[model samples]
Target: MSAPFVLLHPFAPFPLARRTRWLWLGVAALALLLIAAAGQWSARREASFQADSIHRAIEVHALALRGAAAKYSYLPFTVAQHPDVLAALAHPFDPAVLQRANHYIEEVNRRAGSDALYLIAPQGTTLVASNWNTPRSYVGQSYANRPYFSDALAGRNGQFYGVGQTTGEPGLFLSAPVRQGAEVVGVVTVKVSLQPIQEAWGFVRDPILLTDAHGIVFLGSVLPWLYQSRRAVAGSDLDWVLSHQQYGAHHSFALLPWKMDPAPDLPGFRVQTTIDGKPRQFLAVDEALPELGWTLTVMADYASVTRARERTWMLGLLCAGLLLLGGLYWQLRERRFAEQRDARRELEVRVRERTAELDEAHAFRKAMEDSLVVGMRARDLDGHIIYVNPALCAMTGYRADELLGRLPPYPYWHPDDVEQHWHNNDATMSGQAALSGFESRVRHRDGHDVLTMVYTARLIDAQGQHSGWMSTVVDITEQKRSALRQRQHEEQLQHAQRLASLGEMASTLAHELNQPLAALSNFASAAKAFAEQGRQELLVSSLDETAAQAQRAAEIVRRIRGFVRQRTAGQEDCVVGALVANVLALLQGEMRQQQARAVVRVPADLPKVRGDRVLLEQVLLNLVLNSLQAMQATPLERRVVEIDATVADGRLHIQVADHGPGIPAALAEQVFAPFFTTKPDGLGLGLNICRTIVESHRGRFTFADRVGGGTVFTLELEVSG
Candidate 1:
């Protein structure tokens, strides 16, 4: 049978009457016992509240720490992904590239507030440092023994808390792998100062300790033994805090007075609370911060509770004494008891009010939990799924009960993204990080990597215990797909525009080829006539003409090929005169076909320009061909196409003019616009891409009405003389 629970009110009236005096004494005694119990309960409750507050404060500190880590993570990733950095690292120790990379690293470190950032070779040699003041120190050091650098070299991003090889001070090291696709090339390591953490999260004035999985103290404020002190007791402090306390794994208000000596082979610590230097009863709760792999032990003075109990006992004793002393005094005692009864009723009312407040807080928290965008889950270090929130269930399309024990490390990661997923997870799980947010692929319920923006926090159970992790994941699948589609469409548009330009130049090109062929035919006919006449000298002359004609035919073919070839495909060297002469020759046939003759204005001598001769010919052909078409229906006395060439402003400038109707002012500019041609059957891409090609070659193309009654197309090309 359980002992009967007793309730006592400080203001309850004491029952006293002739026959009820004994019963009243018994009632007063019961009240005294109940008051003692209540005092003890209140003390325990206050202690628990303090413990909970401490746990909450630790969480805030961890949040600050994680925020810093997430910031640090982006630095190395940015450096590794930068085009200049990639080009630099692609080569074998190019001094110029390395110097540029060093400068880049310095700039990044300055922005990120990092103490040290450097690149490590696969063999663990420091290739370059953002700050090279200690060159000889870390430049040749072996990072093979360091887990972060080694793991990164093995194609994984890794992090760890360890002593700096160069500074010989404790620090958090984060490393990201530089990969050429699947192969890891180098490691970029960033070292962060823990001092910022101390500033952000109030600590050191209180007992704060940070430990790792190996039980080694990574950080401790105001408690040297918690870190740096090479003592077993310092390392075992966490173990002791866990074993000796009945604190819940959450925030609690409790005071525990206990001690343990974790010194190697030494008597364990002995600790407990004292009141005025005397041993006093105490209560405590354990706060675990699993993310940091540590716990907090909170203690307070329990003597005040004892004193309160003693006071209540003293009051009861005096009341009994007074009641026994008088008949007249009994009336006064009765009045005092009546007052006590009223006070008790008021206390009950206050308790109800406090309970209501607690309920309100719970309701607000529930609302917030339901509205959060990201999924939340808790896991143990061994990768066991312990708990999950409803948001997480919704994200994965799984019921809450199904996700309870399911490990979801990379369920939604694209096959290509799995490796990166593991690397990031490893970094977070290790105390090397606090909180991290990134754009990564998560597996959706529909089996696609729901491109998501995830903000993950290292889970600390209670005090500073290193729980696995909890993340808020927002699906960005639509946005990602949209961006991808936009990029592909842009590429396709560019390709189509290129092809359209080529199609527009076809007519100009036919004229170019026909000119040389016509010359060859004329030369062949002359040779044949000479052969029939048996004129030896004339026959020799005709043979020379035939040879020249053959050369002309070859030149036209080469020019046409160059014009149509992809810009990056080939190279050709020719003088400015030769290129211009070739364009006129090709267009001669088209000019003839259109009954238009070209007036060439090229000088005898011109500086040679290096380029694809064929492409240059194509540019001139297009201009001259347009001049021919412009004059086709004109009633001018002479349908003339004027071709002019000169070197001006360090560039080759050529113009083609026709004696046809002058270009309309409004349509002159619009002619160059793509797909805006005035011709009935035109694709309107010729001049547009002609300008595009010219600009690509670092030149310009423009048009204006000719001086007389036609249009003029101007071409300027940067000369490599």
Candidate 2:
């Protein structure tokens, strides 16, 4: 036989307590059922209490309606007994009797506060009315077939509600007969306004209604409900209601909205519906007005009453649930507190150990920081200095006391850097700046500018909030001065190297000047010989040649003078082809003397390069002359120098290629080094200066061996559009 299976659930109070969950659930179900039964009992009791209240209210309002009607109900009978009313009927055509009766009824209607009081002649014609003086007078109208009129003619007092044939207003028509000894001579009717009673119902805060026998609501507190049928009328009832004009001729005759459930066995007279968009349960009750053949209804809302009981029951249930939960929570909370206390004790021990390690680490860090040469400073979000290490004070020439809690621009900041300092402060505080390195100047202790390179990052506290920015700064003032001095020394050396190149070109320049001078001298001799022969044409030709040679010599002098002129850093757009042509012209005589073939190849439309025109010209000249000197070891027939300019790599590339032995691979890296040269009398600063000049223009100067047994030096300069 199989052993009984037992379940053990982790959430159970005990290992065997899983089955108790269902028992608890069963109890909850029973409790809900009891609560529901209690709610139903409470609802029934409330409904009964509400029904009785509605009934009492209906009876109370019924009396108010009667009192409103009684205000003018006796006026018609009293008018019937008047002599003027009888006299008006006796001599119906006499204006005097009509006037007197109309005035008398007007006084009665005014006192009764009724709509109108009028007399009907025996011929069914309205002879006079209280409103005879007004335009809507009923003096000539007929109500011959009216029940009230017929009943009065038959010698009985009658009451009917109908729309006036003359005036369109609806009211209660009370009629009484005038007697000529036992004969029914005429009828007197009174139209007592129902508006006052309707207004009274409005003050009671309950829905009240007065409906006719046909279930048509003739008077009601709500204007929309007035003259509406309480139920759907059909057949003769609808026709009679219409034909009799029980309601006004303009009434819709539609059924009012009852929205009732037809289910049997529903208790109480409560109706739950929205009235004018307000959801409410109204206790509806109707009472009979026996004399008027009308029903009076009164409605009272019981929503507040029901809600109060529901609120009380719900509050009790809530308090009970809370008390139970509080007990359970107290039990579980103590266990949790024990576990938490153990955890906290363990955490406290671990924290103590970790804190000791952290303290040791912090001590080590403090020692390291004290020994550091770089300065450490921190600023809060508002740009106020919060911390400054000893190194920072030394770097800024300020004491810790002076710098702490100070705001920028700090006194130690260089005067020229104050604006930049403020800008950096704002950018840092606003989180618009990145963590990177920047160079700034601060005042030194000796009253001089100290340059510092700072690396910074935003400071975050233990809570991971942006507390401020921490910056590490290194004083680079001496380094910067040394670099400046080195640059000046290099500039002087470059100048001296350029002068040496000029010095080397002295022999070539002298030979170039000798040709033009010799030509001018020969032309002068020719002019003198022609002058002796009296040949004017020959002498003029000689003089023209002499002038041409003189002009040629002057042009060479001007070009060389301008090329050798020294200038500070300056740049302009130089057309590559034109610049190449100018260099060639300056070295024209030298190339011819060297017996070297110089070829210039450049795109006619090559774009311009931006650099100092003289510097670039010097660079080109130096490369070409170096190529010529290199070719001295080769045969004169193999010597060739090529100057080529082209656009390449979004830059202006000008190459000087020579068919000379290329540089050895091992020494190629050192080709651009200052004072490095293979020539016995050459200063190696030429290539270095060329590279520096190109770099200063944001370009490059490099050399490589050509595939065709030659060395090519290339200058790549930025192209300016």
- Scored by lDDT, the top model is 2
Work out the TM-score per prediction: 0.36, 0.47
Model 2 alpha-carbon drift over 4 Å, by segment: 1-12, 15-363, 513-569, 633-639, 648-651, 659-676, 688-710, 716-718
Q: Identify the candidate with maximal TM-score.
A: 2
lDDT of 1 by residue, 263-339 (tens): 22211222343434655433323345564444543333334545655665677567656755665467686769967
Q: Write the residue-wise lDDT of candidate 2 on 1-721 in tens digits.
A: 2333234334456644566566667766776666666666676676667667777777677777677667676777788888898888888889888899889989988877778889998878999898998888888988886778888898988889877767787778888888989898999888877766776677777677778898888777777777678677888887766666665565457777666543123333566656687776666766889988888877767675577568656865776578668867986887699678768878899999999999999999988887788999899987788888888887867898888898877888778778898877777677776666778888886697778987888899999998999989899889988999998886677677678777878899999899999999999999999999999999999999999999999998998877766654467888888778888888777778788988888988777787788888888888888988888887889888998888877788889999888999999889988889998888888898888878888888889898878799988888874
lDDT value, residue 165 of candidate 1: 56
Where does candidate 1 have its weakest 10-residue lDDT segment?
246-255
lDDT of each: 0.64, 0.80
